[model samples]
Target: MAHATSIQYEPVAEIGGGAYGTVYKARDTESGQFVALKSVRVQTDQNGLPISTVREVALLKRMEQFDHPNVVRLMDVCATTRSDQETKVTLVFEHVDQDLKTYLEKTPSPGLSPERIKDLMRQLLCGLAFLHSNRVMHRDLKPENILVTSQGQVKLADFGLAKIHSCHMALTPVVVTLWYRPPEVLLQSSYATPVDIWSTGCIFAEMFRRKPLFCGESEVDQLGKIFEVIGLPPEEEWPTDVTLSRTNFPPLMPRPIADFVPEINEQGAQLLMKMLTFDPLKRISALNALEHSYFQDEETLTQKKS
Candidate 1:
């Protein structure tokens, strides 16, 4: 395989695009390896790279130090010039079969099995553990950020909102997509890695059912959906820094996990409850979560593979 230092790749096709960049499926000319290249436009206004793009580049550079099957691999990064006078910075990542959202939409099978969901949850937890161990918070952890490889392996990707713990001092809660965003974040609490865990729980539910567990239209509505499932957090459970701490949120008791998603097994429900705990300190960390009973079989599979 050609290292990042080598310039050898052939464009395959455009996979997706967003405001900051366009993702292209490409093949390494030297090794014939397929990879996804995210090309971000170079913006300069007498300053360096855009703050968002720079943050992503820096995070990817740091993540490169560690390698895990469940974490997307950064193959390379290089600058390319376009005839239109735009210099684009391209991020090279290992090719994934498709994003989880797309894969779920295309899967012909019925809903995912309990075992398959467990396997994916374990992989996601492993990837989250890697990120949290390095003191990085993947703020935007949703189904779209979860990619499925051609071999059916699940990898965590899309770190545009990710933040290194010390880079910005304490974490700012101004991140995460609304659907998967933790309630603490919505309430503007001082967030930590637990926020990512909360989002992971939401993704786990979505993967199993092929629909968002809490599909709220607005922030208020979103909180309502969460409260509907997990029950209202007691006043004592609210963090000191959480916004509207003094404001009275209704006292809606949490419903049984089985009531909403009966398809989820008891173990899965337990894991989700741990992740969605109102108290961040009480919430299960990814490191501890990897040892949960839901992943006992996954541990065996991992050992067999090793």
Candidate 2:
């Protein structure tokens, strides 16, 4: 922790690590603000840095304009200059209280009550709506990427795999981790914003149950878990020419959601099922989900029942 010509980075304890970078909680003296500095480890083949990191940095830089309550803020980008080696670029972001994984782990089972679940889901939907409105697809949406602030607000992070619907790149099925991946992605179809809705559904179930709704080890297993809770994918649900790498089409009837989590209410089950729909076209959009009875307030519920 040293202060130099207007730019001082105070390195705090390590927050987390990723494939190419190690994230540390830090303070930027220039702005007198706390930020998460993700330092990309420099490798040698006589090459500078990975192209993927460059892409992430560039995208995140542009995405800074997306200042929303539910979206993680990228503060600044700086370089670390050492004694005698190649310099490294560090991406700075807003410091979050904790990731949803650690948050869930620390909390007791039946941790988040129904009201809290609705609040979290509402915040998630708000974030997703903002991202979709900006045409940004968060390919990876899971507990690990959803962070909770000390103020109890949830914000979406980890834009390394995010794809901004811009003129710069082509849309490919660059699917994220198997767990949060949508059914359309599992079927090898070029995915869109609906994929995030699918992940949000999974996260919503997870927050309510305090565990992964679908803890599948592989793609087939993942699809199996999804099907188990939400039912199988009909052949007509998929596009004719779409290709699947692992699982076969004409899926068998899946097990019931009640069998897995009997405590979930009928409204919750219906909402989850719609989000997990095999057909992207049929999947619930985040905006529409926010309007659903699933997120209804006490007043709204009374009105609906009456």
Candidate 3:
């Protein structure tokens, strides 16, 4: 049944009716602070919470203890059982009014400065690296879920929640875009943390172009779109387990990253290529990506400014 802590949050409005389950803006009566309440209804079925949901929640809670600057704060968690078969798991997160999607849309016609993009990518990678090091794969990463604070802090939200969302939705109605997905995932190959790095690379290019790099309509279409830029991998590079043949894509050579992300410099393009590499094994890890030469300019400029 519904309980006391649930009342502690006075609902202000429904923020999301889609992807992240039911999310609400609520006022914490005690602290007089605003927070986002994301509720997921999980099938209990005699066991308290499904093992998957329990594992995800544990991972989120563990990550919370680190108090990462670039990861959203998970403030509170409450479970209110509605029936023997169902339980509502409400997760309270510190609210941020803007997401990267909104931030990109609001950018002036000239678009974000290279320095601003660098700063955002740096923060994004830091958070991602933290999660990767902790053995957590974000599975889903895109502009909508990457929250941006008023002060321009980039906090990675919606990590470790895809499992919970899927548990509730069966198959979420939200049209999950293949735009940010890595090549392996599109091919139905096994994926790990590198999946997120590929998504970050897509987001990186999007920062420059102010629109998604690859907008594929389906898995095959998305792979074709990706290969159009990265080019089809060699026969040996293709995963043996996937049914999709490398011949499904053309024999075109890799295009210049600059062709798509024109504003990116030589260093940025090189790093982006490493990120978008076809082989998951060859993909750049978030920690290694942070050390890429592309970010050095920003570091040098920071040193000069200080």
Candidate 4:
């Protein structure tokens, strides 16, 4: 911010277009390090940058001070004026070579080892807990949004992007996958931090299966797929405010988690079930998730250093 972005950073290549705008892989001319450039076009008023943008960026900066190993680093932020009405706000972030989605794909044969998966999950929950404790909710938690360093370190990305993308959400053509969505979100009920836990559960199972646990085409279908495994929530547990009635879903009995993820051990299955609980209020918190028996193995300490 002390200097113009152009003078310090050089665009290396076009990475991909995201919800708000195109992201580029850039090199810090001074540090010779790679960074991702995520920019959003904002409507400008007499007040300059939108209040929401300022607040989110400030939060990101504050988070950087913690130097949390699990969270991605926000390298820098700069604003460029495009016209009288529009301004471009670009966020620079440390570039990780791959994401969990691809990492799972590249696993040599069957899939990740149990110890390896536990290590990844521990790093992931540590990051999530850090963000949650700081009051940042990762409304969208999926493989692609989670970056994995070459050394196998996990760093959460795009944690609060939804809020900053609120104004342009409708205009964006990208449709977020509903596979990781929980019943509460699928039913269009109110949600909170517990939403991320559900996604984490899905990812946890995927680590063993090397594929998605519940592949759904629509919100209704997604709920049905989820119910097929976790079973339909009892009438009293269903959110009263949601238009999607509990009766719409078949009254199914809960299936064993082992049925879906046979590779997971018994303790991992229990923790996964806790995270995928139907009620957000009862769903396990990220901090508690870290302490689950599944992650209590002493091997985790050795792997954590790996």
Best by TM-score: 3
Better of 1 and 2 by lDDT: 1
TM-score of each: 0.80, 0.79, 0.95, 0.94
Question: What is the clash count for each candidate, in the order shown?
Answer: 1, 0, 0, 0
**For candidate 3, what is the lDDT?**
0.90
Model 4 gets an lDDT of 0.90
Assess candidate 1 and give its TM-score to the true structure: 0.80
Better of 1 and 3 by TM-score: 3
Instruction: Give candidate 1 misplaced runs (Cα > 4 Å).
Output: 1-12, 41-59, 80-88, 160-177, 242-248, 297-306
Reference-based lDDT, each prediction: 0.76, 0.72, 0.90, 0.90
Better of 1 and 2 by TM-score: 1
lDDT of 3 by residue, 42-63 (tens): 8898668898888888889998
Q: Where does candidate 2 clash, by residue pair?
A: none
Question: Model 2, 176-268: lDDT tens per residue?
Answer: 468888877776777788989999888877776777887777777787777766666665665676656335533567667667656677878
Model 2: worst 10 consecutive residues (lDDT sum) = 163-172
Task: Between candidates 1 and 4, name the one with more favorable lDDT.
Answer: 4
